[model samples]
Target: MTTVQLEHPHAQRRRTLVRGLPLAPAVVLMLVFLLGPILYCLYSAFTDMALTGSSETSFVGFENFRKIFTSDEFGRALGYTLFFTIVSAIIGQNVLGMFLALTMRAGGPVARAVVSAVVIGAWVLPEVVAGYLWLAFLGEDGPLNQILGFLHLPTQDWLFSLPILAVSLANIWRGTAFSMLVYSAALSEVPREIEEAATMDGAGTIRRLVSVTIPMVRRTIATNLMLITLQTLSVFGLIWTMTRGGPSGASTTLPLFAYQQAFQLSQLGYGTALALVLLALGGVFSLIYLRILRLEDGVR
Candidate 1:
């Protein structure tokens, strides 16, 4: 015989406002710092802005984007960017990290600790430092060449002959630890009883991994792929320190190209347009991953 009382709509609104008051500063900061620059960049991408030689900035409509689409350099840079992202992040880091996680899961504690330490040491290195380290390692007179000489193996100048490959390998080495950590956590949450039941049903290791373990961790894998892809797409310091997108622009990705155009060539509008394109590329990747995740959820 108890009656439930309903609050008035105006009081409810006032209570909600009171609760939201504490978030005002953070909301204002985001509007000022985050939304502000994004809006400014959106505006700048359409203008004929430059660092010098142009006293007046004129609205260029799609002129800058047209220049980007028509430019050979932009095409080359876009191709390299895709190559780097796919090779280093999608395939290399993702596969190697999964392998390491599986190995550690099966190995003894000592082995797991040692491997984790080594992998995370590389991961924790600053991007510039890692780039320089790889640069020295791949240099002609570096230890890698010396080791090749000792083994009576051929060792050409790796950085010169395969600049993009070298950088991709460096990125893979530095980034794999993150994926490993992610998979390890996800794997730990997998039900041991389910795995044991699969074992009892005579499923081999590979079969169990493919059919059971992978399905369980698919969400994590997709999330990790999206994150690492975005991070790899934005990589600048590592590539800049290692190659400076040099040796005839063979390794030039969009970020390097944009920087070169904006600062060196003083084509700020074109560079901003390029930046927007890169952002759009990232958005596309994110959308694909999100779509996959939603589909997975629907299936579940």
Candidate 2:
């Protein structure tokens, strides 16, 4: 017979520490790189920090936040931001991508390959490159006006007249591929027999999609919306490259507003405060999505 010897408490504690040793570098990196800047920004948001105006910094304590809410520019920026996000990412990308995915799913092999190539090709291009491409396309004498001219239709400067719409459309064209790919993968996972059964039960294609396919993939839809919404909130390069949030602030979204305030106006404190508000907006949206998803899951 053999008796087991218990390890000492100190030895066990040392072994546990050894097991977690590999994670130390990553933890330290996160603390310095990620958490550090975030904490600094939060602290600065309550102060009177600037890039140039005054070297002295003081704790203003919500003065910056108060000024931002009372400012007309912030209100306009917030409105335009919501409008662009809804029109471009939420509506345009989601609808077009879903349609493309469904169409390709029902198409022949050749059609699928060609469609995938065309759609994904846009996504592969760098953001700035895509921005320039659309910039030219929407310019005063761009392809769109050229086509209108050829058709004997009057053409005006689209970008100058509607800067926000131009950038939103450009974003939609550039970013739709992500939604398409996601929906394509989700669509493939849907059971063929389930669709067939619905069809045999005298259901139309639309009915089957609404009732069966969509319900089955509701989780993917929620996740996709949440991701796209967050991405749209932070879209800066595309809008900046296209419109520069110009035509008299017609397209100045939160990111643009924040950049203009921080860098251009040299109000780093207020800018960081606005940036925090943007972060909070994202959090609110995430909470809404999570709550909706939870409710739906409970119902299911």
Model 1 clash pairs are none
RMSD of each: 2.4, 3.2
Top candidate, metric TM-score: 1
When summed lDDT is taken over every stretch of 10 residues in candidate 1, the lowest stretch is 1-10
The regions of model 1 sitting more than 4 angstroms off are 1-5
What's the TM-score of each model vs. the native? Answer: 0.95, 0.93
Q: Give the TM-score of candidate 2.
A: 0.93
How many residue pairs of model 2 clash at the backbone? Answer: 0
Q: For model 2, what is the alpha-carbon lDDT of residue 245?
A: 91
State the lDDT of candidate 2 residue by residue for 244-270, as single tens digits. 899899989999999999999999999
Off by over 4 Å in 2: 1-16
Q: Taking the tens digit of each residue's C-alpha lDDT, what string does model 1 give over 51-139?
A: 89649999999999899999999999999999999999999999999999988888999999999999999999999999999999999
